[model samples]
Each structure stands twice: as structure tokens, then as C-alpha cells.
Target chain A: MITIAVDAMGGDHAPVPEVSGAVQAASTQDVNILLVGKEQVLQAELKKFDGWKKLPIRIVNATEVVTMEDNPAKALRTKRDSSMRVAARLVRDGEAQGWISAGNTGAVMAISKTVLGMIPGVDRPALAQAFPTIKGKPAVLVDVGANVDSSAQMLAQFAVMGEIYSRLVFHTESPSVGILSIGEEDHKGNELTKSAASLMKALPLNFVGNVEGRDLYTGLTDVIVCDGFIGNVALKVSEGLVDVIKHMLKESLESTIASKIGYVLSRQAFKDFRKRMDYSEYGGAPLLGVKGVVIICHGRSNDNAIRNAIRVATESATEHVNDRIEIEIQRWQASSTNDPEV
Target chain B: MITIAVDAMGGDHAPVPEVSGAVQAASTQDVNILLVGKEQVLQAELKKFDGWKKLPIRIVNATEVVTMEDNPAKALRTKRDSSMRVAARLVRDGEAQGWISAGNTGAVMAISKTVLGMIPGVDRPALAQAFPTIKGKPAVLVDVGANVDSSAQMLAQFAVMGEIYSRLVFHTESPSVGILSIGEEDHKGNELTKSAASLMKALPLNFVGNVEGRDLYTGLTDVIVCDGFIGNVALKVSEGLVDVIKHMLKESLESTIASKIGYVLSRQAFKDFRKRMDYSEYGGAPLLGVKGVVIICHGRSNDNAIRNAIRVATESATEHVNDRIEIEIQRWQASSTNDPEV
Candidate 1:
């Protein structure tokens, strides 16, 4: 059975949700789970479940905990025995096929990259998240917050990784990749996007031309790639705007009795809308380009989010996504070196 | 009476909406209007409106028009007698206090900047748009598409311009200004935002620290400043996402007969929601840092949007916003020079 390590002391509501989610995943999915945290705390939390003794779940103890306020670099260097660090170590030692955490994102990235190391020929790991599109499908956005400042080559690498992930996860035969920019014209956009577009065109994948910000929700392309800074800003801004629209709609609907009745009738539609927009439905973003699978969830993730993240980690490991990424990167490198003009 | 020039031969449905909007503004507002376009074409369009001759609207003859596809700089140079150019000339020749255009944004900006020139101490002009916030108010986002690659100093200038516009337009006593970044922390951002934050702190304004993308709708700050590239991307992304959400809601609601009845009952509430979200309600974005008041509306703007744009131009010119911006820039410059550390 494929094994996964999870940080049990991470996220806003930890230990309880983490333990419950692990138990749920282990019971439903064909995977063994190693819950990494304080043994006493985790054991107590896990005992509350009815059939906890039957699942393929075990506890791994770690003395330290990394708080959200701790500097990521400093925490990675100092908190050697932290739950997040121990989970990463388990992946490195081959005891677990992948690791999942909803803790401090920066600390998780630093520790996971440092412990499991980078896949050969990959410059840096990128965070890829799925956003629902108008086509009733989800699109993958890469480098959401992993690399703030990225080169054209790095963006090209993101395109490759995003394409592979979209195909494997979404089951698309040939995913169309687009470089995010302010305008659709080839000549438009800042220096980075323009250069990235040229490099992406040289790849073996199906590369659509430059796409504007509007294309994100239009589902004009299956995979959208950009630097971490812009991707992070776009993702957060979309989240905030959605909240604002919902608030305004609620306020407007409550202004009159007729509208209130209308809201009750359309309540089912709103429920469906919320479910589709919910972040937990997509689980967590996978940190691609690492040697081993590492899924990072939002810090405010709940029990459902944790369970879904575990599900994502298991799927990624079972699919052998990392092996495919290595093969793609090697092919891209070989092509680039063979053609001097590229 | 204040006078505003209109580009009558611009936008998707030119001369009809343009002429009708001018007549509507002239009759309702206390302003004289100069409609610039081909004399015969505008006269034919104006003839359809009753009491058009009684309004304080005058027609000026122009031989050419600037299409949306034309290169901005080239059009500015070659289309000397175009309607957009003639409107800018009216402002320069002291015939009108300001100009409004629902034409090509880049062409309008180029012509306005070249003809009217920059206010003293201002490096570049910025485009400012008001976005509805959750607080039932609006926040101004500056440099929406003016400068793609802005320096730290230019971003500081945008903050000053945005602050003044927020105080005058939104009527806030002391508008809180924020530099848009990926994170709320001072140390978390790309090179540009980091450097811009340090410079903004030196200015004598109510400067809030760095804000995240989520802060845009939270109404955490009255004015959000960033390079045009990022701001443009953020603005378009918001607009596109809103459309997608609305489309999804409509699709979801129409799936059932009960929901269809609910939609009819809540139709008024949806109308109210759309009115609140409509860009036309905010009139047009002002091209701040320019010597003359120049407002740019969307190319697809209707008569209501055009009319509101004329209203905005009148208010800006009457309030002498250009003078206030000059004064604020001088004050900031004086403070910066006096403080050696800054």
C-alpha cells in the first residue's frame, strides 16, 4: 500500500480535524497514513473516533512545533524535530510516498525542499492550484506563491509542469497552455511575459499564445502560467472579489419581502455556487518540481480541507506524477540544447 | 459656466450616444458643451433629438476619426484634425476646461498628455478607477493602465494623486493610502513594491502599511497604488470574474422551475445589484497628474456612461483638481528634500 505522512498539528483547527481527516482517509482510501505530531496529543485526539483501532494509521512523535509567526528560514534551520520537518524526513527516507501539511506555507516549502531536495534539472518548486472555469471544468494556475521573482526560463518550466499536471489530474488528452499577461497581443505585456511566451512556443506541448487576465475564468486555456508574484496576487484578489459580490447580493436580496422569497427559492442554486467556489473542494495546491509529492493547504483549512488534501497526496503518488515531470523536463532540456537559436 | 469638450466621433456607437449624451448633460448639468466630429454626421445625429437646438451645445467641425485599431502614438501624430485631437485642442486653446472620450484609451492618454502637458513635479499621468467595496463605499485604484513599468518614485506619485482624488471625489477627510503587494508584511513583496513602500512612508500622507490582494474589497484603504501592469491585470481579472460568476448563477438558477419563479421575483434585486456594480455609475476614470482634466470611458459605453463622464469632467475642472495635485506634489518634494534619510 502507498504510504503518506501528514502533519497533525498544522492549520487553524488542528489535532482534532487532522486526526479525524487521517482516520477518514485511511478508512476510505487504499493508503497507509503516518500522522506526525506529539504522540500524546495525537493519540488522545484519535481515540475519540469509534473505529480508530481498525484503520491503517500510526503515530510518529516530534518534540517541536513551528508557529505561524516564526520566520520560515529560521524555523527550517532551528525546528529540526517539528511535525512538518518530520513529515518531510519521512518522505526522504522512503517510509512515505508523499507529505501533506496545512501549516505555515513558507515553512512547509522550505523544509520540504530542503529535506526531499529538488528533482534533477528543475530550478525551483512551484505551487499549482486549480480554479473553476466557465466551461464547467477547472484550470490549473502554476507558481501561485512559490517563487516571487521568476525568470523566463522558470516560467517556461512552470508551463511544462502545469501542462503535465492538468493532463494527469483533469484527464485532458492535450491541455492548452497560456502565459498570463495584461493583453493578448504578442507585442503586449511586460518584459517577463513577452520573453516567456517566446520560450513556451519552443516547447513540445500545445502552447496557445499570450492570454489576458479575463481568460482565467473564460477557460480559454487548460493551463495558465505566470510568475509567483502575479499569480499570488490574482488568486487572492479573485477570492476577495467573490466575497464582496456575495455580500452585496445578500444585502440586495434582503431589502424587500419579494426578494426574500425569491432568495429562498433560489437558495439551492446559491448552495451549488458556493460548493463550486469552495477552496476545500479542490483540496490543496501541489508543490511541483520537488523530488517527492508535497501538497500544501491553506492555513485556515478545516477538517474537510485536510481530508481532501490527503486524498490529493495519495492520487499524486499513485499516478507517478513526479516521474512524468522528470521525463518532460529532460525532453525540454534536450530540445533546448539541440537548437542553439532557442 | 464650465465648458467640457466631447469626442463625438468615438466609441462603438459613435455620434448617436455621443451626441445624445452631450445634449443630456448640457440640459441637466450647468455646463457648456463642444461636440467635436464631422459636422454633417453630427448634425444629422443631433437633428433626431427634440429641443437639441435649445441646449448649450455647439458643434465643431473635424475631418477625421481615430479608430480603435490605430497605433496610439502614430494616430496622435497623423490624425491631427481627428475628433479626439480636436477635443484635446479645445482644452489647450482655452475654449473648454476639460475633455471626455469614450474612444481608444491609449490614444486619449497620448493626445491629452502631449497637448495639455504634465503638471509640474509629476513624472507620469495615472488612470484612476473606483471599485465598489464591501463597506458600501468605493476605493480608488490608480495607474490602472497608464504606466506598465513604473519606478518607485512614480508609484509614490500615484499615491499622492490617488489620495487627492479620493479626498475630493469620495469626500473622505483623510484618505488612507496603501501600496498593493502580495502580503501585508513590509518585507513580503517583489523588488518594486518593497522599494515603493519605503518611498511612500516618507510622504506626508495617511499612509497605511503594505496591503494584500484581499484588502482591495475589504475597504482597508481608500487608495490602492501599484504599477499599471499589475493594476490593469487586477482590474480586468475582477471584471471578467464577475461576469463568469453572474453567468454561472444564471445557469444554475434556470435549471429548475422553482428557481425560475424565484428569479422573476428577485429580478428587481438583481437589477439593483447590477446598478451598484455598473462602471458607468462612477462616471469615467480621471487621468491624474495631467494639467487639464481628462476623463476616459469604456469604448462600449452607452449614453448614460458618456453623460456621466461629462459630469465628471465638469466637477474636476470646477474644483481645480490639477492645482491641488500640483500643490501636494510640491509639498511631498519639499518634505523629501528636507529629510536626508529619506
Candidate 2:
């Protein structure tokens, strides 16, 4: 059974969702869940569910919790026994094969990196999220919000890492990598993308030139790489737009009696649409380039989302994605040095 | 009557949409339309509309056409007699009060900037577009695609210019300006946004701290300012998401017989929803900081959009938004100089 560590004290409403999700995952999957938080609280919360002791779930005591307002670097230095830190430690100690958190994103990255270390030659680990596309499989976006003002070389590394993640996790054969820019032309974006595009061209990966924001949903490429600032803004913009569209649709459907009846009759279709667009269905985004499997979920995630995150963590750990990433990075670095233009 | 020059050869389906839109605008509004293109073709296109001679619309001959694929700077230098250039020339020569185009965004910006000079204190003009918000009035976003790799000073200018445009065009009182970033905190962004926020703080405008992508449609601020790179991506992402959402909704509503019937009954609700989210309702984006009013419509704009663009251009010209922008920019520059921190 794959063993995964859970940061029970993380997220907005922690401990409850974490405990319940652990129970659900343990009941369904052939995995072990180690919930790291205050032992008393986790036990109390787990008791709410039926047959809690019979499942493969346990609570590992953690003394502190990392709040959203804390500075990431400061938290890393100060909060030694924090839930996120303890969870990372569990993975580092080989007690658990993976770690999952829905806490402060920056703190998670800093703590995870400090405890798990980095893959050799990898400067920084990126936050890679799977976005649902209009086409067949979801596309992966790298450096979603991990590092801002990423260098061109770092972007190239993100491209390679993202490509490996897409291929290994999503099972895409020969994933096409594209640099997110204003236009598809070679010389269309700002200085960073221009440099990154040239660097990607030197790599052995399938670099498909530049892509625009519209291509995010079109699934024109399997992996799209960008700096964290742009990636974060793009993700948030999609969320905001989705909220507005749903609100507008709800208001419109309730405006007239006929539309109300129509909404009731088409509820199943709407349910299917919602399921397709649901972020929980894809689970958490993996923090790529780290030495171990670390899945970072949304802070507002519910029990269902937490369960899905645990599932993803189990699969990623079982697949040994980190080992492949390390090997691929070394190969890419060697090949990059061979190219004189690089 | 206010005179507006229409680039009759612009847009995907040119001349047809332009002539018909001009006829519609001339028939309704007290405005004269100068259709700039090949004289014979425009005249023949205009003859299709019933009693077209009675409308205050006429044709001006231009020998050349600027295609979409031409380089912006090269087109400005070579396509002297192009329809876009002629229309801009009419605005520069004071024969027309405003210029409107639905084709070649970069070409329009280049030709308009060259033919009609910039405001005295402005270094580079910005493309500002009003977006529909959940609140009362629409919020405005600046530097959508005008200049990339913009400096902090240029971003501050965009903020000031965007504020003036919002106050004048949207009739907003004391418009609040926010820097677009990953987070709303004072220090939660990349270097560009950080420096830009500090610069905006020194300005005379009502500077709200940093705003995020999720804040774009929330109407939390009246004006959101960013570099062209981020702004352009945000705009395109919204467009792409809207397209996907609409497509999904249509497919869902037609998936089953009951849903198909429900969709037929709820057509009015869907129409109302579309109208609320319609880009034509807000008309075209304005190229601010130019000496005269210049409205740049989308390449895929229909006849209704063209008519609305004419309407917006008339209002902007009559309101003398450029004069306000010049005065506001000078006032901001003077205030910024007085502050030692800036």
C-alpha cells in the first residue's frame, strides 16, 4: 500500500475536511494516510465518521499550524513542527511516499523544498496544474504561482519539468511544449519569453513555438510554460470569469417562469458540465522538480477535493515520477551544453 | 454634427459591414460618416441600403489596403494610401473629429500615433478597454496591448491616463485605480508591479493598493493598470473562457430531448445573458493619450459593433477626454516630482 502524509492543520477549514477525506480515501483506495496535525483534534474529527479505527488512517502529532498571513521564508525558519513541515518530514524519512497540503502556498513550497530537497541541477521546483481543455486531455501549466520573475533559464527548466510531468502523469505521448506569449510568432512576446523560446528550441523537447492566452483552453499544446506571475494571474482570471458567467447564467435562468422550468429539465446536463469543469476531478497540482511527490491543493478545497488530492498523491508516488524527473533533467542539461548557441 | 471617419476596408468582412453600419449610425445619430476606401467599391456597397443617399454618409477614395499579416511598423511606412491611414489623416486634418477601425490592431495604433501626435507630456499611449463588472459601472483596464516590457514610469502614466478615461467616459466620480498583481497585499507581486505600485502611490490619483486577477470582474476598483503583456493575456483569457462556457452551455442544453425543449423555451433568458456579456454593448477600446479620439474595434466585429463604435467615438470626441488626460497627466507629473520618495 502506498503511504501518503496529509497536512491536517492546513487550509482555511482544516482538520475536518482532512480527516473526512482521509477516511474516504482509505475506504476506497489501497493506500495508507498519515494525517499530521494536533492528535486530539484529528482524533475527535475522525470519530465523526463511522468505523474510523478499522481504516488505514492514523494521526501524526504536529505542534503548530502555518497560517496564510505568515511569511514563507520566515515560517520555514520558525515553524519547525508545523503540520506542513511534519508532513514533508514524513515523506523525507521514507515513512510516507507522498505529502499533500492545502495550506499557504508559499509556505508549502518553502517547507517542502527545505525538507525534501531538490532534484540535482534543478534550481527551483515549479507548481504545475492540470487545466481542463476543450479538447481530449487536460493540458499542464507550469510555474503557476511558485516563483515570480522567473529567469529565462528557469523557464526552460520549467518547460522540461512540465513536459515530463504531463507525459508521466497524464500519459501523453510526446507532449508538445509551448511558451505562453502574446502571439504565436517566434518574435512576438516580451524579452523573457523571447529568450525562453530560443532556449527551448535548443532542448530535445518538442517545442511548438509560442502560444496565446486563448490557447489555454484550446489544448493546442500539452504543456504550456510561463513565469509564476503571469500563470497566477491567468488562473485567477479564469476563476473570476467562471464565477461571473455562472452568476449571470443563474440570474438569467431564474428571470422567467419558462427559463426556470428549462433549468429544472436541463439540470442533468448542467451537472455533467459542472463535473467536467470541476477542479477536484483533476485533484491537486504537483510541485514538480522536488525530490519527492508533493501535491498542493486549493485552500478552499472541501472533503471531496481533499479525497481526490490524496488519490493523485498515491498515484504519483506509486509511479515514482520524481526519479524520472531527475534523470530527464540531467539528460537535458547534458544535451543543452552540447548546443553552442545555448 | 460630429464627423467620424470609418476605415471601410478594415475588418475581416470589410466594406459590407462598414457601409451598412455607417448607414445605420447616420440614420439614427446626428453624425456624418466618412467611409474611407476604394470609391467605386464603397459606392456600390452603399447602394444596397435603401435610400442610402439621404443619410449623412459619403465615400473617400484610398488606393491601398493594409492586410492583417503586414508588420505594424512596415505597414505604417509603406501603406500610405491605405484605408486606415486615410481615416487617421482625416482625423488629423480636422475633417473628421474621430477615427474608427476594426482591422489590424497594431497597424491602427502605429498609424494613429504617427498621423495624430501624442499628448504633450505622454511618452507612449495605451490601449484602454472598458469591461463589464458585477457592480453599477464598468471598470476600465489600461495598456491592453500597446507597449510590452513597460517601465514603472510608463505604467504610472497608464494609471493616470486610465483614471482620466474612466472619469470622463464612464462618468465615474473619483475613480479608484489599482495595480494588477498576483495578490492584493502591498508587496505581493513581481518587480514590475511592485515598482509600478510605488510610482502610482506618488501620483495625484486615488490609488488603491494592488488588485488580483479575480478582482477584474468584481468591480472592486474603477481602473486597473498593468503592462501590456499581462493585460493582453488577461483579456484574451477572458475571451477564451467565455467562448468555452458558451459552447459548453449550448452542448449541454442540446444533449437530451428534454434539454432541447427547455433550451427552446429559455431562449429569451440566454439572449438576455448574451446581451449582458456582449462586447458590442460597450463598443470599441480607445487608444488613449493620442491627440484625437481613436477607437479600435475587434477584427471580428459585426455591423452592430461598428455602429456602437461610431456611437462611442462621438461621445468621446464630444467629451474631450484627450484634453482631460493631458491636464491630468501634467498634474500627476508635477505632483510626482514634488514628492521626494518617487
Candidate 3:
């Protein structure tokens, strides 16, 4: 059975949604669940469940909870017994196959790295998010805010991990990967993208060359890679724009009665569309290239987000994604190291 | 009266929107118009209006037309007789106070640099687009695909230009300017933003320090600046996300009849909000740090966009934004070279 460890006292919604989500996952999935948090708070919430006693759910006691506002490094040190740190340790110690957290992002990255260590040949761990494209296909965007100043080699590793992630999760055969560049031209983009693209173009994987920002949701390629800096800016800008437009459209359609009839005829497709666009339904981003699986959920995650994150964690463990990644890295090591493509 | 030169042969809509927009501007404002294109075509389009003989409109003879698909550099070189090229010449020769094009962006920038030249002490020109903020304020984001690889000095110039643009167009006093960084901490971000932030912080302008991508449209800062690679991605991704959300929302509101009624009650305010979020309503991006006013309209601009571009071009020239930018750059150069702020 797959065992998933979750940080119970994480995210803005706190123990309520976190514990409830774990309970829901327990009722549905056959995975053994461990929720790490203060026993009193978590148990009190769990008691609200209808049939929790029959499920494969367990609780691990932790002395402290990590606040979203706390500094990542300081919190990891000062609150060594915190739920987030303990949950990460569970994965590291092999008590659980994967760890999930909606807590401090920096702390999760720090703790996950400290405990599990980087994969054999990977430079740094990357956060990989799966975006459903216009073609209704899953495309993985890597290093969405992990490594700020990544080398060409690091980007190549991200592409490798992204390819594997897309293959395992969405079951794509050698997913097409593209490095984000200013222009699609080979000679275009900054020093970093140009160098990285040249190296990526030579990889054995299905490297489709440079893709622009608009191509992220276009589904023309399966993997989109960039350094954390550009990727973070692009992600946040896209999120903010989405929020603004949602607010704008909600305001616009309600203006007149005739338009209201126009809206009624399109409701079913619209609900399905909204459900498709919801990030929570896709669960948290996985910190790939690590020895153990760690899913980092958004701070504003709801009960559904927590549930999906657990589901993601369970699926990753079953697929043995980390083992596959290690094998891929080893297979690529000698060529990547001795040849140093680029 | 403001003399705004119109490149009648420019843009996808061509002489129809261009001529109609000129008539609209002339009807709406007391500005002198010099329409530069093939005289016969422009006259035929213009003769469709009654009482056109009394308006302060004049047509300049030009035989060539620059197609949207033409190479920017090649068009500027071979199409010296094109309407777009001649319009730039008019601005260069001081016959027109400003020039506006709803045609090819590359061609506009190319011919403008060839004719008008960049302002003294300015490193290079930067493009700034005004995004609507939460409070109806417009935040200017610079380097939206002008120069991909920017030096620290170039970014500092963008700050100065952004300040003047915000003050003259956006009407913000001192215009709190921010360098887009990965994090809010002083030591955060990649090399470019960190160095540019140091330069910006040392300047005399009201530098509010580094801001993240989330703060771009929150009215947190009057001006937001970044390298073209990051800036272009942010703008395009934001536009794509906006479209996605709008499409989703139109679908969602119609899902329920009661929600449709609620939307109807909120229609007018929503329209106002939608209008506020649109970038096209703000006319076009100015090629800042140039000697003369040059407005680069969207390639797909309609008559309304052409009209707005004329308005913005008129306003910028009247306020001497180009001269102010030169003065600011000169002051920044003198202060740095002599006093050495850093």
C-alpha cells in the first residue's frame, strides 16, 4: 500500500481542510495516510468525520506548527519538531513513500532537500506543475520558481525530469520538450536560453526547440522549461491576469437581461470549463529530482486542493517516479558529464 | 494646435480606419492632421465625408506602402518612399510634433531610430504599456519587448523614462518606480534586477525599491520596469490568461439563472471594469528615450485604436515628454559620472 505523509497544520485554511481532505482521501483511496500535526487539534478535527475509525488513516504527533509568514530557514531550525519538517522526515526515513505540504514553500524545499537529498546526478530539485492545454493535454512546466540562477546543465536536467513526469502522469510517449525563449529563432533570447536551447536540442529526448510564453497553454509541446525567475514572473502574471479577467467577465455579463439569456444557454459547458481551469483540481506541484516525492500545494489551497495533493502523492509513489528518474539520470550521466553538450 | 502625423498606409485596416480615425480626431479636437500616403486613395476615402473641406486636414503625397509582412529593417531601407517612413521624416524635420503608426512595430521602431534618433544621454529606447490597477490608476510597465538583453545602465534609463511617462500620461507625482525582482528582500532576484535595483535606489526619483510580479497591477507602484525578456513574457502571458478567464467566466455566469440575474444587476459596473482592464483603450506604447514623439500602435488596431493613438501622441508632444526624458537622462548621467551615487 502507498503511504503518504501530509502536513496537517499547513496553508491558510489550517487543520480543518487539511485533516478533512486526508479523511476524504482515506475513504476513497486504499493508501495508508499519516497526518503530522499537534495531536489535540488534529484529533479534534478528525473526530468530526463520520467513519474515520475504519479507514487506513493515522496521526503523528508534532510539537509545533509552521506559520506561512515565518522565514523558511529560521522556522526549519527553530521549529525542528514542526509538522512540515516532520512530514518531510517521514518520506526521508522511508516511513512514507511521499510527502505533501501546503506550508511555507521555502521551508518545504529546504526540508525536502535536507532530508531526502538531490537525485544522484541532478543539480537542484525543480517544482513541476501540469497545465491542461487548449488541446486538453497535460504539459509540464518545470522550475516554475525553484532555482533562480540555473545553468544550462540544470535546465537540461529539468527537461529530463519534466519529460518523465509528463510520461508517467499523462502517459505521453517521449513528450515534446521546449525551452522558453524570447524568440523562436535559434540565435534569439538571452545568453542563458540560447546556451540551454543549443544543449537541449542535442538531447536524445524529443526536444522541440524554443517556445514563447504564449505556447505554455497552447499544447504545441508537452514540456516548457525556464529558470525560476522568468518562470515565476510568467506564472504570477498569468495568475493575476486570470483573476482580473474573471472579475471583469463576472461584472460584464450581468449588465443586461437579453445577455442573461445568452449566458443561460452556455452554462453546462461553462461549468466544465471553470472546473478545467481550477488549479486545485490538478493538486500541488511535485518537487522533482529529489530522492523522495514531495508535493508543494498553494498557500490558499482549499479542502479540494488538499485532497488532490494527497491523490498526487499516492499516484507518484505507485508509479515509482523517483526510481525511474534516478535510472534516467544515471543513463544520461556519463554522456552529460564527459561530453557536456554545449 | 498639435500637429500629429498619420501614417495612412500603415496597419492592417489601412486607409479606412486611418482616414476615419483622422476625421474623428479632427472632429473631436482642434488638431492639425497631415495624412501621409498615396494621395488618390486617401482622397477617395476622405471624400466619403461631407463638410470635410472645412476641416484642418491635409494629405502629403507618398507612392509606397509597407506591408505588414515586410521585414522591418529591409522595409525601412528600401521603402524610403513609404508612408510610414515619410511620416517619421516629417517628425524628424520638425514639420509634425509627433508621429503615430498602427502598422508594423519593427518598421516603426526602425524608421523612427533612422530619422528621429535617440535622445542624447539615453542608452536606448524602452516600451511601456499602461495596465489598469485596482483603483482605476494606470501602472506603467516598461521594456515590453524593446531590448531583450538590458545592461544596468539601460534599466536605469527605463526608470527615468517610466517616471516621465507616468507623470505626463498617467499623471502620477514623482511616480513611485519599482524594479521587478524575484523576491522582496534586498538580496533577492537574478543579477540584472539586483544591479538595476541598486542603481534605481540610488537615483533621485521616488524609487519604492523592488516589487514582485503580483504587485504589477495592484497600484502598489506607479511604474514597473524589467528587462524585455521578462517584460514581454509578463505582458503576453497576462493577455493570454485574461482571455482565458474572460472566456471561462462568460461560461460560468450563465450556468445558473439566478447567477445570471445577479450578473445583470451588476452589468454596468462590470463593463466599466472590463474597459479599465483593456490596454488598447490607452492607445499605444511610446518609443521612449527618443528625440521626438513616436507612438507604436498594435498591428491589428481598429479605427478607435487609431483615434486613441492620435490622442496620446498629441498629449505626449504637448507635454514635452521626450524633452523631459532627455533632461532626466542628462541629470542621471551627470550625477553618476561626477558624484557617483553607487
Candidate 1: C-alpha RMSD after superposition: 1.5
Please report how far candidate 3 places residue B31 from its true position, in Å: 1.9
Give one digit per residue, the lDDT tens place, for model 3 in B84-106.
98898899888999989888777
Q: Is the docking of candidate 3 incorrect, acceptable, medium or high quality?
A: acceptable
Place model 1 in a CAPRI quality band: high
Residue-level lDDT of model 2, residues A275-330, one tens digit each, is 77777778889999888999999998888989988988898887788888888789
For all candidates, state DockQ relative to the true structure.
Answer: 0.83, 0.81, 0.37
Alpha carbon deviation, residue A293, candidate 1 (Å): 0.7
Residue-wise C-alpha lDDT for candidate 1, range A222-309, written one tens digit per residue: 9999889889888999999998889999999989999999999999988888877787778799999999999998888877888888
As a whole number from 0 to 100, the lDDT of residue A74 in candidate 2 is 96
* Docking quality class, candidate 2: high
Instruction: Give candidate 1's whole-model lDDT.
Output: 0.90
Compute the lDDT of residue A195 as modeled in candidate 1.
Answer: 90
Per-residue lDDT of B1-342 in model 1, one digit per residue for the tens?
999999998898997888988989998999999999999999999999998999999999999999989889999999999999999999999999999999989899999999999999999999999888888688999989888879999999999999988888678789999988888889999999999999888888899978788889888799999889888888888988999999999988898888888899999999999988888888889999988999998888889999999988998888788999999899889877897876
Query: What is the alpha-carbon lDDT of model 3 when measured against the actual structure?
Result: 0.84
- Model 3 chain B is weakest, by summed lDDT over 10 consecutive residues, at B261-270
Sort the candidates on TM-score, descending order: 2, 1, 3
